[model samples]
Target: MKRALILAALVLGLGGAGWWYASQRDATGAEADPPTVAVTRGTVERTVLASGVIEAGTLVPVGARVSGQIETLAVELGQKVKAGDLVAVIDSLDQQNEVLKARADLAQIEAQQASNAASIREAELALDRTRQLNRTDLASTQALEAAEATLAVRQAEARALAAQRDRAQVALASAELALERTRITAPVGGTVVAIVTDEGETLNASAETPTIVKIADLERMVVKAEISEADVIRVKPGQTATLTLLGDPSTAFEATLRFVEPAPPGIAQNDAAETTEAVFFNGLLDVENPDGLLRIGMTVQVSILLERASDVLTVPSLVVSRGDGGRSTVRVWDPASRTATEREVRTGIDNAVTVEIVEGLAEGELVVAARDSDTASAAVTMRGRRSVFGF
Candidate 1:
């Protein structure tokens, strides 16, 4: 029996001792079992593993442009708003007072001009009377000239008062604008993600604009994924990606690779010779969130599709062997001759499960995966072909 097994192993070109045992089992029940699969057309995909946090693509902070105490806040956290929506109101008593004071100053200027105009009229009448009296020789020439000079002085005073009124009008306009600033409004349309300040909080805008609320466009969520530098080269814009949140492992969503950052966010300054810090590149992907299931800062597992082939001849990845000089070899099972023949083939993209056969193979042909496990007979079809892994 041992000599017969050796002859069978030599005929099949199976060098493994495990395969010799399987051949014995097949010899007795050759019609019952076979460890071979037919080459078929299928799809294969290669993916790059990554992780990141989900966030809104656009974030807007609602802030106060003027310094004042908050009197009223119209919107709450998570509230949706449109552009120009009134979000908050600051204490505008001071601003209103300024506007009133400016208007009062303008009123005073107008009142003074009224009195000046009346005085100018009286001076003109006196000058005309003086000229008549001088023509009739009843008034002195010096008196007539003095009346003319008084009329000129009154007209200059009226002109000066009118200039003061013009300045007061500009001051009133400025005061009114300051009052408008006290009413805060949303500059963009989005959801109010956060409320930075409560009612009655003092906001100082003299140095910088004080943010009152945070707004975000949550309709589209973006993930800023970090891919290992080793796999970053394979990621590119417009690639396909899928992400699953850490909280819910069962649900997954589709996204499109939007961008790959040119550089790391920031590099640390280090001088250690043996530092083993792992470097990563930033990648961005956008996903639809019409249902709002995704939120900002949510942790997610990401997979980026690097390569894919559809409707191509493929076989189990285990059956393809990698040899020297980047060559690949596979064993073809010929049903008619009942023998194993070694065949070299060109391969394309591959995944953990299958490999794409680009050339040197035809569809519907049997490919050997591995030697059978049972060593009972020459018909070594011990295990099912689909589950067999070829070394």
Candidate 2:
């Protein structure tokens, strides 16, 4: 009975081993299927990124023409103003005093001029009387000669006084003009961006350095973007662009390319060295800032649209594999057979994520992005079998 029980135990162990092997085979079969990906063919866009700053197209610098103590400031920084508006007032007391002194000097000069004129008339009358007396023989010849000499001397003195009066009048007019220029006014309709001086601050007009107040027209603006030498060739004037402000990421402003600097300003070229690097050109974009949201010196990101393709065939960038022979290839998946077939293709305008398939690819076709490890192993095994059999 013991021998029979041991033989039955060995039989049960063999059955369990066979059942475990069958289950393993079933699991292996289930794992043999290749990984699949949904292929999509759609239009792809290529964009060039460049960092820049938002700026006003027309920036006018407002400076003080005449120097004096700052008496009153009519506008503050960031205050909106109109053309011909009063911006600030220098100590008009000194200026007004200058005006008053000039006027007084002019009045004094005119009075002197009238006195000279009266002296000239009196001299003429005296000369006439002396001449009449000499003709009547009631006066000596020497006396008549003396009267003529006195008249000539008085006329010369009157002329010199008249000349001095005229000079004084000219000086007065110049002083009046200088006094009028003391009131600082805005040259353009814009906002005051900065104020350089406060009330009671003394300024020097004759100083070599000028006190400056900054102003700008916020209604219109421009972006001066520097396009890299590699991609500058694709940019041109009149091209449309979009500006994204660093301050407000949600706001996107539209602009048009107005100018491209032909030669880089203030850059020296090295011809002796063999270099692929070139100088970048400056591009200007005119933008409208109607709401006055954009300020001067605001940083921005610029995307220059060089070229656009609509409804063109495209593929994923990873699927495109470069061959050692300089040929580009992609794995086209056969849905029914669950196999990937390699095909040579030509590409154009490859962006970071997607590439434009110019030839050898069609819409609604499956392309393999990656292969499962098991599928790769199976492929290797099939290739090994073919090589061993010389098939």
Candidate 3:
């Protein structure tokens, strides 16, 4: 009886082990199917992301052409100014003296020219009288010759004075321009964004023009976006773009692509071979800022639209897996069979979030976006298909 009871206990243990194994297998089978998302008709766009800075479409730096001390700064920072409005004043005392000298020199040349003209007229009259007397035998040929020489000398003097007068006139004009330069004015209509030089600061402009202020037209703004080298080819002028300031991300500013610079900014200054850094090209976009909300130097995020499609079939970008030969595939789930089958699809633009499905997929169809980890087979399959980057 003891041997029979031991054998029966062993039999019961075997049965319990079999039941546990079967239950685990059933649970694994139930969770093996991957999670799915429905493919639907929607809009999709391909875009390139870039960071940018706000800049004035028309920015001009007001500087002094002549060196002098800043007598008065008329416009302060953030003050609105129109074209030709007085911006600042340099010490005009020296410029005034120079102007006076130029005018006096010009006047002297003019007076000399007038005197020479009178001398020429008197010499002509004397020559005419000498010639008449010589014909009547009253004057000698020597007297006629002397009068002719005097007239020629006076005419030559007049010509010299006329040339001097021209030089004097140019000098006067230049001096007047220098005087005008002392009274700095806005070259463009905009706000005074920066004050580089202050009153009482002497500006030495002999070497270079000293900047007194920076003026920017806030009504229309330009964004200078730094586009990575990889994306530079995709971006082009006339493309639509959207800009959002870091200060206000929710508010988007609509803009248009102006142009992409041929080379990176400051590239000429940098040694190409020695520079071992990522290169980025500048892309410009124009946007209107009538309210003056967009300020210069404001950091911004920019999105350039490369391609777009409307009312097309789309799926989450991750759901579509890329295959060899540039083919795209997605796993379509069959509700009746309770299984997913791989389906080849032709894709259009992908905006990183949603991908446009051109063919091989239908609306309302379910596509496996991801798989459960419990299903090692499905997980491996999904991993292999996700290797494709942005389309």
Candidate 4:
């Protein structure tokens, strides 16, 4: 039922638009009963239009590396922060205890090494005495060998104790680093846009770093536009573009195209009853936001200028019918004779609405494009429904 009503509304809207268009074509003016416009030298531009969103060009997602309960959240959402500023603090009691334990272990190893050194000295003295006795035939060869072996063992033990102390020192340093990491600091200077975790929130960041906050440079804004595949070829980097927000269509801002994705994706637009699969290429435009009027995810209309001609003789392209080859004719109105006559003219640039007249037309000449007769007062909507807003 809902779909049927929507379809009916669309049909009615289209019919109304058609009636309104035909009526406007018949409206009478000072000279005739049809709508006519004068041929004049002016500038005409052709543009490709698209819809997009305004986003921060540089956005940082701050995350926690270690898992612990959040002890202090220093910055709130929308808070400005500088690099190295403390943003959050995690529980550090366990890490601190680990550091203390590592220190104790290192100290114990050092004491053991000292004792082993003393033992080595004592054993060396005994080996010297045994060697002297053996030289005098007072000690057996086995006694000398035993004393030498004891000294060697003591020295080996000292070396092993030194290695253990070195490893313990490294462990202590690692533990200290872990303890310092409990105090999280800002990576860059920006405004905090989001705060995912709060004080007392436990974060398990083992599998992946859990986002604590989001920071973004709001001044550097970019527009992510999706251009239809049919019109994407006309758009390229370095093209001038104009953007208008959905809410404020009258206010426009200028931008420059910076990037266009080569690999276009299939975009799926879902409706209540059907789905539309469209191929679109992604484009990026760098927009200046000094006034801060734009925001993240705000919908904007993008118009990319493809071609522009200045001081060119232009006419409504729709009324100019084309013949064989390069021949085109337009119904030029003569104000003096009050008659319409078809005149063949050379054409230049032609767009959906306007065409440039190269010859066979003069300035101040009139051509009937539509009629301003009945004034049916029907609505003049550009389309039955806008594809951008999907309504």
- Candidate 3: the clashing residue pairs are none
- Provide the lDDT at 367 for model 4: 87
Give candidate 1 misplaced runs (Cα > 4 Å). Answer: 1-34, 109-167, 267-276, 335-337, 371-391
Residue 2 shift from truth in candidate 4, angstroms: 42
**TM-scores, all models, native as reference:** 0.72, 0.68, 0.78, 0.74
lDDT of 4 by residue, 1-391 (tens): 9978987887787777766666544355232245678898987788999999999978999888888999999998889899899999999998899999999999999888888888999999999999999999999999999999999999889888888988999999999998988899999988899998889999897899998999888887999999987999888899999999999999999999999987654323432322256777889999988877999999999999998888988888777877888678888877677778888898887767888888999988898785322343324335444634265
Q: Kindly list the per-residue Cα lDDT of model 1 for residues 1-391, writing each as its tens digit.
A: 9967866766465446445554545557554234788899999999999999998979988898888999999998889999999999999999999999999999999999999999999999999999999999999999999999999999999999989999999999999999999999999899999999999999999999999999999999999999988999888899999999898989989999999987666543434322266777789999999999999999999999888899999999888888999898888888888787889999998886899999989999898777332344433443323322232
Better of 1 and 2 by TM-score: 1
Best by TM-score: 3
All candidates in order of lDDT, best leading: 1, 3, 4, 2
Against the true structure, what is every candidate's RMSD? Answer: 8.7, 9.6, 8.8, 11.4
Order by TM-score, highest first: 3, 4, 1, 2
Write the residue-wise lDDT of candidate 2 on 1-391 in tens digits: 9967976776675456545444434455642333444445667767666777778766777767677887778888888888899877877676678778878877887787787778778877877887888899988788878778877887787787778778777877777777877788888888888777777888787865355576788888988888877878778888888899876878798888898887665444543432456556778888899988777788788888776666778877877887787688888888778667888998886776888888987787888766224644554454345332232
**What is candidate 1's CA lDDT for residue 353?**
85
